[model samples]
Target: MVDQSAPLPSVCDLAIWEPVLRLTPEDGTERGAGRSARVAGRISPSGYSIAHRGSMPSTARIAVQDIQRELARGGVREVVFRAEVRPDGLTTLGLVWPSPAVEPAYGSVNLGVLVLADGSLPAPWLRRPDPVPGAVPAPSADPELLERTLRERLPDAVGATEEEIAAAEARLGVTLSDELRVLYRVAGGDWADDVETAIRVDKAVGCEIFGVEHLFGIDAASRFPGWDLGATDAIRTPPDAVVQGLAGSPGWIGFGTNGGDVFAVDLTPGPRGHFGQIVLLGHTESLGAEPVADSLTDFVLGRLREERPDRRGAELPAVAGVGTGRLASVQAAAHPALEVLSLDGGDGPPFHLAPVAGLPRLRTLTAMPGALADPLEVAGLTALEFLALGVQEWRVLLDAGAVPRTLKAAAVTVRHQDHLPVVPVANEILALWDRPRIAQTLLEGDLGPAAAPA
Candidate 1:
């Protein structure tokens, strides 16, 4: 008889593993799986490895294909044929498996292999997906796959109805954004059952879908008001280098004064677009005239999505609250093809207005109604490329010494109702005004270099 311990044949083996779960099955009392059994610690690149223990079944060859598809849903990267084995009085067996990367684990683990020699491991006990090191013995040539990874695993919240979502899209004159679309479909208007669970999965283990808010068109500031969602926070708009850390956590996503104002949205839900829920705290009054989305939480998300890229050319969201403390406090950050910002204005706690260094390619800014008022300020926006402010707000900035050191171009017009001096100031500085459409005047020359009177 062929020795059964010869490592089996190369392409016909099946391997299984079960990751240790922190909690024991207490007679199905727990609502969800408890914490992972794997402890937390530094894991060496080569600390653990896995290999198959036996051969696969002959009749189950076709059945194995179905398993591959299901595993993909869980974000398994690759799968391939592993080995073949001949049980002593039993027929030879064949097995196939995936070549998943060995990630760090904190606790004890178990691996199993099935040999189908008339008396092999029984069904249901043959294989299971678990957190195991080097288990399943990766298949040699598995192709890569695309899957949505959830960053946070909070329980699912209530989803929007098809009709409700459609109305929102029409009212906004834009789509619901990609991620929101997915949530709408998956949630089917009822997702509270798995909202919290989903969040935990994202925060703890590596899952197929990550709840990154950055991926979607929605801005973190509007989606989650109250926290310093401005340039200070990381997840919504982290720098180029810190992007990876923002993608995962113990890091958080929010915008407010004390930090209790937390908000999180899933970025992957709207793959073809973008979508997720937004939580608000302390500043329910922050959301503007637009109606709230589904719930107050979702309302924030809907508004954020509206500001993102639309199907038509790269359209920009109208900036609301420009010159006032409202516009001054609106957080701004750089995105790949565009920028993400929140126009919600309020008495915010101190926060950063720009990245550590600065954003170089900012092109345009629009003002929403009531965005800019008498006390407007725009003195610090030196790197801005294009400036568009409500005409009335522009005068406020002019009155408050709102000066652009090097403005390449500008488009300022107070809204219809109010009227201010067409030309507020006159100085050599006025000559520096890039264009002359509204109030054109020549500066009176530098007055003793004291910045031309306040």
Candidate 2:
């Protein structure tokens, strides 16, 4: 039998192979190269199984023990980890931390090293580094408009004067987030977007910003990996799956507004505040100036300041901006079946449709007064769910003037609309989505037009 100690063969001699791996904690120290060691498995570096002509030698067994010891050192613990194999058959090491509070998705990670039977090393074990506490994913290139908006436009409006804040409060009915209030009070909103397309705190706050009272939102990709953050039109890009952001950095976000625009901020007092990418709520035709943009910013800034240093929280004012009224009106016309959606100017389509077509869920959708002029694209959603459609947003009822076979519970309502002319093709529309029966049974009569002009 070949003596195991007889100088081990090079990695080229093994018929099957397996990789050597390393694991580290969230804030673990950088591992040294001496950590590398070999195992007893007589395998190749590129494969998982191993074989040999004779029994394993004492030296090989000892090497495996040493490797295991190094892997489990410090805060790093050893555990079985799997990676999604690519077409090329190569695998990348995924690092996972022990805490359920961090990188929970990757509960355990396979270290990064390919060990040879002879104790030779293929490469250094690698792992992902933690991101800056409040880093916001920014476009590789600077977004000129976003920069100007954050730095110049917002600062100028915010710094106007105390009179400005008072006037804004009167105009827009709602109070602002504490962070926004601080900005308005301190720099008077005079600021610059130092991070180009992305936003970050000028400094880091030692405390976590997740649940600061009156602070409202503090979203991080590390916290919510599933968040979608591509420019509306950039949905096809791969990075959209792993973009980072503050809680309200735009895109479609749920602030627990419970179907309203009212959102909260992080209650924790920190320097990071809510500095991150956010889709500007206004700035487009999505919604008319129901809420004055200036006032909303002030209210939010004031709220932010009150929470800083040491200050008492104030009662949020009962204010209704234009956004609320517009949303309310839009909701009135919203029908679960035929919904009209609006996209923030900068935000693209709804995330649910990303893998499908590219459209964000619209906050306000008004339904048409009568027969659908065009067929609606709603493959992403299953039937029976409610869809909101805005007025004047025509949808094709069918192709080739034919109705759909599946639409039964769909209904249409018009918000902020009154005294419209009768629909010209209500009967034809009923025949399209195969809704004639629904029209007669559910609609309760003729697929007739509204008595007034639409």
Give the CA lDDT, 0 to 100, for residue 199 in model 2. Answer: 24
Tell me how candidate 2 scores on lDDT: 0.25
Per-residue lDDT of 278 in model 2:
25
Shift of residue 214 alpha carbon in model 1, Å: 45
Q: Please provide TM-scores, in order, for all candidate models, with all chains considered together.
A: 0.21, 0.18
TM-score of 1: 0.21
**Tens digits of per-residue lDDT for model 1, 303-379:** 23344321122223222232334345444333332332333233333333343124443323434334433223344
Q: lDDT score of model 1?
A: 0.28
> Candidate 2 on 306-402: residue-level lDDT in tens?
2221111111111111122233322232343222233221122221222222223221121333322233544433321222222233234333432
Q: Which sections of candidate 1 miss by over 4 Å?
A: 1-357, 368-377, 391-402, 420-430, 434-454
lDDT leader: 1
Residue 218 CA error for candidate 2 (Å)? 12
